[model samples]
Each structure stands twice: as C-alpha cells, then as structure tokens.
Target: MAPLRPFLARVEAKTLLAVLLTAAALWTFVGLADEVAEGDTHAFDESLLLALRSPTDISDPLGSPAIETAVRDVTALGGVTVLTFVTLSVMGALAIRRHGRSALFLGVAVAGGQALSHFSKTFFDRPRPDLVPHGTEFVSTSFPSGHSMMAAVTWLTLAVMLARAEPRRRMKVYWIALAALVAVAVGVSRVYLGVHWPSDVLAGWTLGAAWALLCLLAARWLSRRGDIEPERGGP
Candidate 1:
C-alpha cells in the first residue's frame, strides 16, 4: 500500500480529533448527569433556575392569556407536527427520486438518530422539575429532554439535507444557522417553562449534536462510495 499524502494525513488527524472531542464532551455530560442524580443538583438545576428567574420580570406585553396561548400554540403537537411531517416527506420523496444506495444510508441515518433519541429518554427516566408553573402538560421522562432532542435532531437533519441540496455557501450557512437557532430556542423553552432541568437540556444538546454529526458523516461516506449523487437543486 502507498503512504498517505501529507494533506490526507492532516485531514484524517483533524477528523479523529473532532471525534475524540465529541466523545469526551459526551462522557463528561453523562458523568454530570450521574452526579446530579446522586443529589448534586446544585450545578445544573440552580443555574437554570437563576437564568429563568431573571427573565420573569420582563413582562410579555400581551399579558398572561396571550403568553399562555402563544406558548401553548408553539408547543402544541400541531405546530412542530407539520414541520416534521413536511421535512420527512420531502426527504423520502427526494430519496426515491435519487434512487441510489446513498439514499438508503441517508434514510437510516435520519431514522436511526430519531430512534436513538427515544431510547435515550427511556433509559434516563429522570423527572421534570416542579420549580415553576409548567405551561403545558407533559408525561415523558425528563433527562435528555424529548423536545430539545427532537428539535435538534429534526432541524439539524433538515439543515444537513438542505446543505447537501444546494451548492451556494451563503445559502447553506443561512439554512444551517436558522435550524440551529430554532433548535436552541426550543431547548431553552423547555427550561424556561420548568418542564425540564438544565442538565436535561444540556445532555439533549450534546447528544443531539453528536448524533447529527454522525448522520452527516454517514451521508458523506455514502457519497464518497458513489452510492448517492450530490443534490444539485437549490434547497
């Protein structure tokens, strides 16, 4: 076998470094969660409470009724439901249109990430915080918040798909940034409404981001293997 080129070696090193960093962060988060579970909730829970309390005085000009209504509407199944359905539908449609092995890889990546999120939630089984009034009733386990995880996974997946679909750098940045902002907002909302602890949100973010990266890597690998063609249309 021939020796690898210097540039290729550097690229491989950088990729390995990134994977290591991600793994370390994930391990740290898991350890933090474990510590919190052992009655050291001061670290994450207290910080979140302080942050949420600071914004309490900033009144929503619309009043409690309007605020509640808006929150309810946003958090309602219908709001994100439509977005989710539309995104997945488009991905499926595109995959069929492409009809390649790469599409199979993309499909698995997206679906597997979703399944992993659900599995993680069930494994954690941590309860939601009762410190503040919950705006919406929820019954799921709290650690690694479902809303936060799902938001990150879905939006990030869409962002990846959008990036792959387009070649313009500016458009790619805009699409990814918008998706990221929405995901972060949804995660923050969970804490603000007292439905999830800060640790839950943090874990959700860390794991969700890692999962998205993994999915993107899978897509890239498939593309390299000539299993799927790069999307040429504007996203």
Candidate 2:
C-alpha cells in the first residue's frame, strides 16, 4: 500500500505553524497586557470607541432599525456562552461516536482559554464602555471579551479538526474559510454593539487562536500514541 505522503507532509507543516503562531500570540498578549497595566489606554479600545461615536452624516442605507437589530442579536448571548456551548456540544457528540481523544483535546483547549479569559479579566478589571449604548447588559470585567475568545477558540478548533479529517481538498479549504469568517464576524459584532472594546476583541482572538493550536498539537500527539482513534466515517 502506498504511504499517504501528502497527508503526512501537510500535517507536519500545519502542526509546526500552529505551534509557532501560538507562541507568537502568547508573547504579544503578555506584552499588550503589560502596556495596559502601565496605563496605555490609547490603544485599539479608544480608537474603536472613537469610530463608533463618529458622526454618520449620511444615514446608513440599511437604516438604524436594521443596525440595531443586528447589534441586539449579536450581543444577545454573550460570546463566551455561545462559543463554549457550541464547541463542547460538537466535541461531546464526536466523543460519543468513539472519538474520545479528540473530544478530550477540544474540551481541554476550550477550558484553558476560558480560564485565561477569566483570569485576565480579573487581573485587569478593565471597565466596560460607558461612552455608547450597550445593546445587552453584562457585568463581567471587560479587558479581554469572553465572547470573542470563545468564538475564536471554537471556530479555529473546528477548522483544525476539519483539516485533520482527510476530507476533499476543496471542502477542507471551504470549511476553514467559513470558520475564520464566523470567528471574525462574531468578534467584530461585539465591538460594533459596544459590548466589548476593540482591544478586548483583539486580545480574545489572539488567546483563542493560541489555545486552539495548542489543543490541536496535543490531540495529534495523543492520536500518535493510540489514545484517540479516528471515528468511522470521521470528519
């Protein structure tokens, strides 16, 4: 039988890139947090606020009602809850189908990201925006948005899983693109709705991506160790 040369090569490259990116993200996140601690408030957060408050001389063609509705919907469920639930549920289903190892990896990755988000919020205790009307009421500390983090982690994790499933080449690319779009859209929505500062969303995405990559690497290691067998008709 011929070896799956292309498949193996892709996996090696993906894993290496994931690790490098994850490390870079962590370094950037730490540096940003330190800057914020040193009272650097002129970052993306302030800029985003300015953009939101900028006058729209020309009325939005979509109208205020449409914009408001979209904002309300996006901020309805906090990003954390929505992403966590979706990722966990999908992982759980996969586990039940005998892909226990992959599921475990997913679970750990999400949990780690959540923990980091919570800790960062507590550490920074950054206040929520009061300059604009918030579409939804929330009381969590707001440095790094939980919703943004979850959205990134969940969608990125799914993308990694899809890539590993050995699906059709075109389909794999489509899935990865779709997941990336959703993750970005969710983060942007949080900012547009005045629920999270732009900096918060940016930080969330960085941490989320880092966590997902770490999780994928861990999952790959487990698979090699015979700890996580691919499911029948998997991916």
Candidate 2, pairs of clashing residues:
79-147, 80-147
Report every candidate's CA lDDT: 0.68, 0.71
* RMSD after CA superposition, every candidate: 4.5, 5.7
Best candidate per TM-score, number?
Answer: 2
lDDT for model 2 comes to 0.71
Q: TM-score of every model?
A: 0.78, 0.80
Model 1 residue runs over 4 Å out of place are 1-21, 50-64, 76-80, 92-106, 231-235
Over 4 Å off in model 2, which ranges?
A: 1-11, 54-63, 76-81, 92-97, 230-235
| Tens digit per residue, CA lDDT, model 2, 127-216 | 887667775667797788777777777778776765665446777678678777777877777777777778788888887778877877
